[model samples]
Target: MITTDLNIKFYTYIYKCHPHLFSSLARDGQIMGLSLRVRRRGGSGSKKEIIPVTSCSEEVEITVPSQFQCPISYELMKDPVIIASGITYDRENIEKWFESGYQTCPVTNTVLTSLEQIPNHTIRRMIQGWCGSSLGGGIERIPTPRVPVTSHQVSEICGRLSAATWRGDYAACSEMVRKLKMLGKESERNRKCVKENGAGLVLCVCLDAFSENANASILLEEIVSVLTWMLPIGSEGQTKLTTTSSFNRLVELLRNGDQNAAFVIKELLELNVAHVHALTKINGVEEAFLKSLNRDSTCVNSLTSIHHMILTNQETVSRFLELDLVNTTVEMLVDSENSVCEKALTVLNAICETKEGREKVRRNELVIPILVKKILKITEKKDLVSVMWKICKSGDGYEVEEALRLGAFKKLVVMLQVGCGEGTKEKVTELLKMMNKVMKMNGFVDRSDSSSIEFKHVKKPF
Candidate 1:
C-alpha cells in the first residue's frame, strides 16, 4: 500500500510537469496497472481514468515474429508475396531483388522458375494482427496488397470481350471494357501491359460487332471511352477501325451524340490521313461534324477534324453541300471566335474545291460576304481568300458581281499588299481579276465610279 502511494505520487508529478511523455509511455504499454482518474485544467466536468504504469524493469520490447519478416529485407512484411521458390518476401523488396538481376530466392538460394509474385494473404493478415495488438496503433496500418496487373489478365479481358461480342452480350461487354479502363488508369505500366496484350484490337472488334445493335448504345459509349485511353493504336487495330463498315459505324455513334466516339474517330483519322477517304463515305459524317461544331465543348478539335477530312477527301464536299453545311458553316462564322472562324472557313474552302461545291456555296448569299469579312479579321487568310477565289472563279457571274458589291475587291488588294504567303497572294490576285472582269461585264467599265467598288470598307467586317 505504501509503495503504491509512492508510485501514484511519482506519476502525478510526471503528469503535472511532463504530461505528454507520460501519455506516450502509457500508450506504448510501457506502463500497466490500475486505473486512476485525473482532471485536466478547464475540464468539462468530466473525469477520465488513466492506467497506472508498472516500473521500468517490467517493460519488454515488442519484437516482430521472425516468420512475419520478409527474408529479402529482414523487415516486417507489409505486402507479403510468394515467388516460385515457395518463399515469401515483402512485394517491394522482392521486386527490387528480381529487377537487380537476381534469379534465385534470397533465402532458399533456389533458382526461381518464374518471377510472378502471388500475394500471401495468410501472412499479410497475420502480420496485420500482430502489428495492431503489439504496436498499440503507433505505426501505420498495412494496406491490403494490390496484385500487380499482368499481361495475362489483360489478354484474358480481351478474350472475354471477344467472346461477349460473339455472344452479343451488352452487359458482359460493358463490364469488361470498364474493367480494362480501370486497369489502364491505374498506372503507365498497366496501360502498356494492357495495350501490348491486344486490348485495343479487341475493343475495335467489339465496337464493330456492336455497331448495328441499337440496344447496345451504352456499351458502345463504354467501349469508345476506353479506346481514348488506348491511343496510338497498332496498324492492325487502325485498319480494323478504318474499314468501311466499322468506320461508318463509328460515325453513326457520333451522330447519336457519342462525343467519345467522335473523339476516337478524330484521333484515328489524325493517325492516318488515308482514313479520311473511309470517313467521307459515311453518309451521316458531315452532319455529325456539324452537330459537334455547334454543341460540343471541343468544337475546335471537331472543326479541325472535318477540315482535314475534306482536305484529304475532296469528294466529300458534295455530300457536305447536300447536307446544307454551306449555311451551317457560314452561320458558324458569324458568332464563332477567330480560331473557330478560321477552321469553318477552311471547311468551306475545301468544299469550294469541287464545281458543285462552289455553286452550292456561291448560291448562299452569306458565303461570299462572310469570306470577304474574314480576310483581314482572321490571322490566316489563305483559306479565306481561297474560298473567295473558288466561289468567284468561272462562275455564272453572280458570285463575282456579289463580291464587287460586298467590296471584296479592296480587301483582296489589302491582303495582297499585307504580304501574305505566295499561295494566298495568288488567290487574292485571281479574285481581284475575276471581280474586275465581272464589273466589266456589268457595264461598269464606262462608269468612272466603277473602280469605286474598291472602297476601303463596304459595311463592316463582321
Candidate 2:
C-alpha cells in the first residue's frame, strides 16, 4: 500500500512538472510504468538515437552546469551579458532588475558604476555548445542572443560622440559615429533607443560643427548614415534643427552626392517646413531637390518636398520649371507606381495653379495622351479628372482639342456610364462640356455616337 501511494505521488509530480513527457507517455499507453528517454552518441562515426530507461530503476539525471545558469534566475542563461561589476547575468533578467529601480547589481548588491552590459560571447558560445552536445533530445539549444542595449548605454555613446566633436577629434568622432551606425543597424529596438537617448541632437550638432571641415567629409557621411536611422525628431527638436544654416549644409551634402543626406533632409522638411518661410534664402536647394528624384528610393520623398515647397511659395514654381520639373514629372508618371503617380499628378496640379504651369503642360506633346491613358488605367479618378479640367480651363481651347483627339471624350463617356464618385462625375461632365464646346467652335461636329467610337487602346467598360 505504501509503494502504491509513492507511485501515485510520482505520477502526480510528473504530470505537473513535466507535462510534455507525461503527455507523450500517456499517448503511448506507458503512463502506468514511467519511462524517460535520453539521447546518446551511438559510436564514433555512427548516428545518435534515443534510448529509454525506467524511471523507477537507475534514472538518468540531467543537471544544468553551474556556470551556464543565471545568478539571479538560476535558469540557464540565454543571453549572458557582463555588467559593469564584471558579473554575467541574462539580458532580460538584468533589464528587469534595472527597471525595478535597483541601481546596484543583483548578484553583488554593490552600486553599479555603469549600467552598460557587454555581451559575454565566449560564455554564450560555451553554453550553446553544451546545449547541443549534452542536453541533446531532452532540451532545445539556445539561439544566439541579440545584444541588448539600454537607453543609458546609448546616452553614453551619444555623449562620447558629442565630446569628441566638441574636442575636434575627428578620428574619435568618426569611430563613435560608426559604432552608433552599427548599433542602429542591429535592430529597430536599438534605433528607437538611440533616438530616445538624444542621438539626433548629438549627431546634428556634430554635423553643424564639422560640416565645413574639408577633412571631415567621411566623418560627416558616417554621421549622416547614423542620423538616417534616427529620423523624425520631435517638434521641439525639429524647430531647432530646421534652420537656414542646417538647410544650406544639407543641400551642400546632397549636391556632393551623399544620398542619405537627402533622406535626412526629407524627414526634416516633412517634420516642420515652418522654418522654411523664405524659399530663395537657400540657394540651389530647389535644384538639388529636383535632382534627387532621379533615384527611385528618394523619389517619393523628393516629390513630397516639392509639393510642400510649391505650396509654401508660389514663386518656387518658376524655379522648379527652370529645373525641368514638368518634364521630369511627366516622365515619372508613365512608370511610377500608383501612389507615386498620384503624388506626381498632385504636384502637376499644384504647378498648374500658375499660367506658366498650364503653358508647360500644353506644350508637352505627351501630356494629353498620358493623362487620358491614366483615366482608364489609374484608380484615383478624382486627381486625374482634376488635372484635366485645370488644363482645359486654363488653355485657349487648344488643350481641349488635343484631349478630345486623344480619345478623352470616349474615356470620359465610358467612365460616366460605368459610374464614379459624385466629385469625379461632376468633373468629368464639366470636361465633356468644355471639349464639346471646343469641338463645335473649331468646326468639328459633336455627335452622340462618339461613345460608340471603337477605341484602339481603351476597351469600353461595359
Task: Please name the candidate that would achieve the greatest TM-score relative to the true structure.
Answer: 2
- What is the Å distance of residue 98 in model 2 from its true position? 13
Q: If scored against the real structure, what TM-score would every candidate get?
A: 0.57, 0.68
Clashes of 2: 0
lDDT of 1 by residue, 69-133 (tens): 67665566888988998888888899889879999998888888898888999988877776567
* Whole-model lDDT, model 1: 0.74
Give me the runs in candidate 2 sitting further than 4 Å from their true place: 1-130, 138-143, 278-280, 295-298, 413-425, 436-462
Summing lDDT over every window of 10 consecutive residues in candidate 1, give the lowest-scoring window. Answer: 38-47
Pick the lDDT winner.
Answer: 2
lDDT of residue 16 for candidate 1: 70
- Local accuracy of candidate 2 as per-residue lDDT tens digits, 366-444: 6776787778777777777888888888777777886777678878988999899998899899999988887787766
Q: How many clashes does each candidate structure show, in the order listed?
A: 0, 0
